[model samples]
Target: MPSGPSFLKKFTSLILSFGPGIFAIGYTIGTGSVTSMIVAGSTHGMQLLWVLLLSCLFSGILIYVYGNYTLLTGETALFAFKRHLKWGRVMAILIIIGIAIGQWNSLMGIMGISSNIIYEIFAIYFPGISSFKYEAVITIALVLTAVFYALLLVGRYTFFEKILVVFVTIMGVSFLISLFMVYPLPEDVIKGLVPSIPQVKGGRMLVAAFVGTTMAAATFLSRPLFVKGKGWTINNLKEQKKDAIVAAILVFVISGAIMAVATGALFYEGKPVTQVLDMVNTLEPVAGKFALTLFFFGTLSAGLSSIFPILLIVPILIADYQSGQLDTNSKQFKRITAFACLFALIVPIFGSNPVEMQILSQIFNVFVLPLVILGILLLINKKSIVQVHKTHFLLNIGLGLALLFACIISYNGVKALIDYF
Candidate 1:
């Protein structure tokens, strides 16, 4: 029995403590993840599930390490890179360019897929709408983009966190329910958890894409920003670690559920899924209309959740490079964010194949992983920057292995991109 003011204070503290991690989950489990997981399961069944698990596992480690670095140094990733090591500025520039291109491609795909799904839903419910017009689709995409930017423009970090929590809840619960409707076999899931790559053609490329997208370089780079925004420090390291673990677990569970639903509903069927709409059509017969609708909205929410962060990432990167504060109220910040959000419109307005663009963005994402990993490894181990929080030998070893894995994936990603072009 505490006083009202005291109880409210406690509650606010609790919410703030978990806010960064929840934001991470919201940012991580977006359209790219939903698309990747569903495609993997639909095309290859649960054979690649281990890749999701391992990617999340590695992502969790790297995320924690990066957060820890920021807590100890009071510096964001780009600043740390700039201040600590030689060639850091060049690496930062490369990272910014890579992430900008990848995010631009993803922004187009997200808006395109979300608008398409909405248009289809409208056509289904409203018989008067005879055809799915590109005009309507583009209009919806523009509206969605405007709404996302408006929210970011007005909202602070707390508000953004609350919105993400709502989105993550809606998307997570909907996907989980849909998964239950067509529950995958436990034995198949168990087999999927075992560490083994499929022998199928393009399996290596698929694995690389999965790893690249899940353990994305942007996610790691963004971690420090979130941590610093939350005002976390060495004293809050334990809480930061807990937050990272929770975010990682959420990524695994939500991603696994998406794959499970796809595996149970689409695998072994002769049908091929080329887009999100194809998923809905295939799932309608197997999981019924209710589940299909849930999945559709769930996917839409995922797309929207992802857009929020993509809008802010460029601004954050710029802020970090300039050694400036992450003040949403600043004119420069708003301008950069608005431009990034609006720039996505070009693809939907002009691109012929949104799905191909999305896939290409994911491949581009793979090329950046090794660079980010190497940067973090070099910075974190340096006693000059990290101080007493210098990475322990075991953690360094783990990161070293991750760097090696990222390098291999980068090679495969490059080869895949060449093949695609």
Candidate 2:
């Protein structure tokens, strides 16, 4: 066997190649996702695991499909939609509007929840901070937004990717530690693989939400841009596939860890998770201070990791709308990031319901998913564009299945939203 240094070098090289995928994990598992997975676990045990599994499965396929398109053609998703297909302009505009709205709304909840987490952390060590909840959260939100925007101005795509890798690593390691500390039964987790939903009143909606959160339009749509930003091309096809696989697996593992922790710590005890502190306190009774702190760290990492990408979404998409070249130094990029930071302030300032914002964001996300898939379906299959690199029959079948899944989830998500209101 090679010496320790050589093995370490190979491992480091492998991890570095997955920059875009790691970026996806950080982007996908924001505070909203944490709450959803925890609530799913606490309420239904591992019964909803099927939803997460299938979502991640299709998520990988779509990532590969979308990234493959860019690798083959050297064009971003939105530009291809607007430039190539019939009625392409309308479709591109609609996607832009849809994803932008969903993402900004999600940003509000992330900033709000993340701010509350910071406040909660303070409150734990110093009880006096609890009385000034609004003031505390607001100040933290301001500082976080400012720090993130500063980092935005100072760095380019690789810089952002490197930062997310840190957060993702922290998040994954924290959650894995907490999971090993307290775990659900293997039989329960095994049962989740069989695919069934809880028969509760809003069970269908929760399942739809599981899909919405995991199989995000943003995750797939943005992959091409990230891949191109990594300076990858068709020659990097093997690496791209490996990256997508790693990312999808990470999503499943991290999300599954959250679910398992909730199941072991909260489900058996019948504890509720309506707030950030709920899960924290639940873990406290099960595994003491260390596990609780780890959970908090995981959550903070998830939130901070998400904030960077959420701020970049508008600028990135607008850049993709023109083509795939993202100039962080451009005035347009600066103005958009500044604008998104303002939106992030709303929830912390006025105090909106995080759960409500989360639900609404998923509704918008699920509704746009079908269109997102169909557009790519057209482009990936076009012989004029993809040449000999056209999608295979199996991949087209997978896309068809993804489209059908998207439509189903959209219907359930809308129904859930109506019921919620």
Candidate 3:
């Protein structure tokens, strides 16, 4: 470690250039994703690592494709859809509505989980705050909502990205520490790469949630917006691809670490994670109190990072729908984000199980995946619009595989929901 200011300087330099992808990771790998990974890892050990593997793979491809579109055509994803394809206006509207609903549902989970984690941390330290559980949780969630809303009102796009960089760095370090302290067996991890679904209840939904949260439609759709905000062009294609790769790799490593930690510390003991408290305890014995504190901080950082972006997503998507230019200081942006932050309070205040709510919210994103992937597939292949920059054969094949994967998972998501009901 470099001393004092030099260490801070190098760290800031390291992450500043990785803006867009870091923002995406900041949004995707949050409390919802963490909770889902913990539940799956605790219940089924490393069996579902394949789901995480493929999700990160496809996530990189989709992010590259979406970012590439803005690079080539200088158009955001929704605007490209509306401008090129027929019935695209309606399609864009549905996307706006669908993604908005799913992301809002996600906000509830993020807020609830973060608040509850704070509650857990308090209960662990003081041991008496257990009686004020709901009161403490609601207060934390409300304060967080207000703080994020205030940040939205005052800060620009780059400001939000900078803040997320801090969150990502902290969570990354925290989880890595926990993983090192309580890593799973090499044989079990290797077996996880072979791909076998669990026959137990909620297994299918966990699969869908893993895919949905990692390979999120919101991630791809919003890539163009973030790319444009970064002010990249065709000249920056390589840089954009590198950023996407970084995002995908971080998603995999951080998420996998959390899962592996759970497998090592919880699964062997025959414990199942149904709540945030279960997650906190997953690091017990081997890692002890300090590790548990770090883990909760990671969860808390993940939640805050996600909540900020989730609050802004509605305005960002709507901005793309109306015009590619995002006026962050505009009334539409402030009003939409304000309402979203307010809406996020409901879950923490009255919700029973944030973990279940989070997994359900993540699974919901899968239902929108097929259409999202198909729309991009059609757009990238359209010669009239793409001209010389048309998608190549290999990428097209990858997109095709992605489409198939999306459809299969979408079906699973639906069936799982039906069974759940």
Candidate 4:
């Protein structure tokens, strides 16, 4: 029906339209995946391999549903929930606040993790200047934040789109490099493919940690912003689905490679890695320090890229709630951004265990996921939206299962917190 070049151009345009979901994948697969993979390897030696696979599958489905819901409603998840579910606005507001706090906490955790990895590699190469580590982290953070702000301030959707594409490219390449260089044993690694729970000496705590790492509740909730950013409408369901499929598959692949690397390198050494930096050090022998440096850079890119959008969303949520308006270029936007920046800076000042904060926020996130999914499912199925695109029975069942799993993890995490206190 069309000429070859014309058809190819249209196809490329269609693919480009799927930008938002791919970008959302960046947020989830960042420091979150790093922590999760490290936990899987260092603690149980791939005993929780099934968790990674299962969570990715479930997360992919959730992302697709959220994207589709946004497209059908022509509104972001927060706006849709607020406008249509006015009675539940208070609860929705609370959940949004929780997500915002979670984002801030996550940004800090990512920074700490990235800096530690960078510092470790620097120590290996330079071999003398331990004094430079803190200064290096500060310098890196400032530069990164400035770059993120500049890109957003430019107010060009195309720039955001290109940044996301480049990051995804880097992520894919960096992972492949690590995977190849690590040279993992094929048979033992293949054994990890079979799903089975590990017998951790500390038992339930380890299991809960595994769940926290794999599930990544806030990452799931963050999908709506990226989906909305693409400006897709109800007419774009098919293209959106394709985007979700590609992005989800990419997440599974990248995260799986990370777990494999950790398992091959650390599990064999019988190393203990309570934090992400430990994971970096564990890889030193197998992939060498250079490869580890690449890994840290990759981790930094993942974390830093997420900072702008995450910081932006918190203010956006707060402003939209109080004023019943959505203005990107308002005083409210600037105020919210300041608050996010303050939150980002203040967490490190508290001198708390950054890793523990990440774990705690993740647990809190699990408690929030079921409610968010419930809101998404309910809002998407409304007649005013695309009543025809209402969630099918199987989709309902999957969301129900995700909710059920979230509840289980929440109960476990709360118990762990109680024990900690």
Candidate topping lDDT: 3
Scored by lDDT, model 2 comes in at 0.84
Ten residues in a row with the worst lDDT in model 1? 351-360
Predict model 3's lDDT versus the native.
Answer: 0.87
Best by TM-score: 3
Across 1-421, the per-residue lDDT of candidate 4 in tens digits comes to 5699899799667556556765656666767556756666665666666666666677777878877766665566666667788555865677776777666777777656655555666677887767765666665555555556666566554566677666766766777687777644777666766866555444445456555545555554545555555566767788778877777787877777777767767777888567655665577777787778666666666666556556666665655455433345666676666656656654344444556556555555565666776776677567777667656888888888877776776787677667666
TM-score of each: 0.93, 0.95, 0.97, 0.84
Give the per-residue Cα lDDT of candidate 1 at 78.
Answer: 84
Q: What alpha-carbon RMSD in Å does predicted model 2 have with respect to the real structure?
A: 2.1
lDDT of 1 at 103: 78
lDDT score, candidate 3, position 308:
80
For each candidate, what is the lDDT? Answer: 0.81, 0.84, 0.87, 0.65
Q: Write the per-residue lDDT of candidate 2 for residues 106-186, one digit (tens) a residue.
A: 889888888888888888899998888889999999999999999999757898888888888889889999999878999
Specify the poorest-scoring 10-residue window by lDDT in model 2.
354-363
Instruction: For residue 41, give model 4's deviation from the true position in Å.
Output: 1.3
Q: Which regions of candidate 3 are displaced past 4 Å?
A: 1-8
Give one digit per residue, the lDDT tens place, for model 3 in 126-188. 998888888889999889988999998874778878888989999999999989888789999
**Model 4 clashing-pair count:** 0
